[model samples]
Target: MGGFFTPDPPPPSPPPPPVIVTDPEAEAAQARQDAIARNRRGLAGTIATSETGLLQPSQGVGKSLLGE
Candidate 1:
């Protein structure tokens, strides 16, 4: 009788939300560092793109646009 009333154990509760405790001071320091890094832009001398620009299999090296 109880098994009929239980209704499938409520679908397992969705795995809980992510827990993140951010530090204000650390966040501010990171922001400042990011600002300084932003000033130093790389590959400024030449334009870069992700596309290989070649139709055939043999072509020039493919360069990563974001360097990642």
Candidate 2:
């Protein structure tokens, strides 16, 4: 491969931009906000399907443990 001769190497590229650093406090606040929103959505769903609607729990006799 290098038996003959190789050309000069290319010039070095410029340095990359600065790295982005995240704030731990801000990250924690965002996580807490997201969790609160998720819990609110779940509560809304539970209220919609609560026993107050036509889907109330059955107060009938309990199932027998033995195969009577």
Q: Candidate 1: list runs displaced more than 4 Å.
A: 1-9, 42-68
Clashes of 2: 0
Q: What's the TM-score of each model vs. the native?
A: 0.42, 0.43
TM-score of 2: 0.43
Indicate the residue-level lDDT of 44 in model 1.
Answer: 50
Task: Report how far residue 61 has shifted in candidate 2, in Å.
Answer: 36
- For model 2 the local lDDT of residue 51 reads 56
- Candidate 1 lands at a TM-score of 0.42
Q: Residues 14-45, candidate 2: write the lDDT tens digits.
A: 89999999999999999999988888877456
- Model 1 lDDT tens row, 1-68: 24866766454568878999999999999999997776675455234544343323654456646674
User: Whole-model Cα lDDT per candidate?
Assistant: 0.64, 0.75
